[model samples]
Target chain A: DAGITQSPRHKVTETGTPVTLRCHQTENHRYMYWYRQDPGHGLRLIHYSYGVKDTDKGEVSDGYSVSRSKTEDFLLTLESATSSQTSVYFCATTGESNQPQHFGDGTRLSIL
Target chain B: AQRVTQPEKLLSVFKGAPVELKCNYSYSGSPELFWYVQYSRQRLQLLLRHISRESIKGFTADLNKGETSFHLKKPFAQEEDSAMYYCALGDTPLVFGKGTRLSVIA
Candidate 1:
């Protein structure tokens, strides 16, 4: 796949429960990102990592926390899942600062 | 803050006909733009980038910083080109526009 893969392709959770989604990349890229795709919002960045343990928040980072303990792995955790947080999540990686990103198959999460 | 706008929610064209998907962006600094496509049951993949200036699958896009537009164009669209196309602006984390669902009929 030359690429990344997201775990738990589809998940159904209840409100106030905690959940974690994993994004694993085999490309050895330095930059990784998490984004949520919604109907009217397109894809909004939730969190991103520049290097191992170096992370930052994106436009829609309020309820999401991310960790990049290794170069090939980035994990996004929802402290307390909310129904509003349900959406399709995508993971991406880029080799260059001005290059196009490659995305993984999305994970569909539903918070009940 | 950077933003990408895809004006048309849906665009339809017959096979062998010309097709264009409009995309506009807002950024203060030197910008980078890209186009991504998603076919049914497939992962989102990069189609092209403005910096490369390369044409993929007979499609090309010119980055217009003046108008902040990077429109995807193809002279003769094929049925295989039907997919959800998204325009993004950024190098690391992107600002993506609501995608344009393209349908090419034979």
Candidate 2:
């Protein structure tokens, strides 16, 4: 129930196309993260940003790229969308290192 | 590396019955464990953390370092308690288990 918002709550696109999912926050938190949720896999981090222009890959970052140009915005871009990438993507934000993360409602993406 | 294991994929208990969801982890250094829950049509949220050590919604989780387990328990389950629960470890970036879906029947 934080101020985090993930755009395009539901999206459907064809494979091999480029896609970008946007996460915007109003809390001005210092950390933002992108995670994908799939059956049998609780939630896997794709990328995270500590600050503006500072980002790092996570356990499952092979087909995903991210950018954080501002404190409140983190972008996840898939250069070429694949069917395997179709899943519910969530964005979370935290203010401190050990604080609980506040998650967005999530974006449900589908690739056909 | 930190890894959390949730043995059960699904758990079913009748209302007012005791409930326990098992969770075990593997980590060398000290760990900060947590239990996150997601109700139907709701986003994932923190239910309890080892650091806090406080029960939430009649649920409690004890961190057993010797056993490397943090099991969530409740004396009396409620119908609303039916949801998906995830056990996670770490602070900055958490490592989560596959999750266990609890079904509390009335």
| lDDT tens per residue, model 1, B1-106 | 6778899998999999999999999999988888999997678888998889999999999999899899999999999999999998884566789899999999
Residue lDDT tens for model 2, A1-112: 6799999899999999999999999999999999999988888999999999999899899989999999999999999999999999999998875678889999999999
- TM-score of the A-chain for all models: 0.97, 0.98
Interface RMSD list for the candidates: 1.7, 1.4
Cα error, residue B70 of model 1, in Å, equals 1.2
Question: Taking the tens digit of each residue's C-alpha lDDT, what string does model 1 give over A1-112?
Answer: 4478899999999999999999999999999989998877777889999999999999889988999999999999999999999999988888765677888899999999
lDDT of 2 at A40: 84
Q: Candidate 1 chain A: minimum summed lDDT over ten consecutive residues — where?
A: A94-103
Specify the poorest-scoring 10-residue window by lDDT in model 2 chain B: B88-97
Native contacts recovered by model 2: 0.55
Local error of candidate 2 at residue B83 (angstroms): 0.6
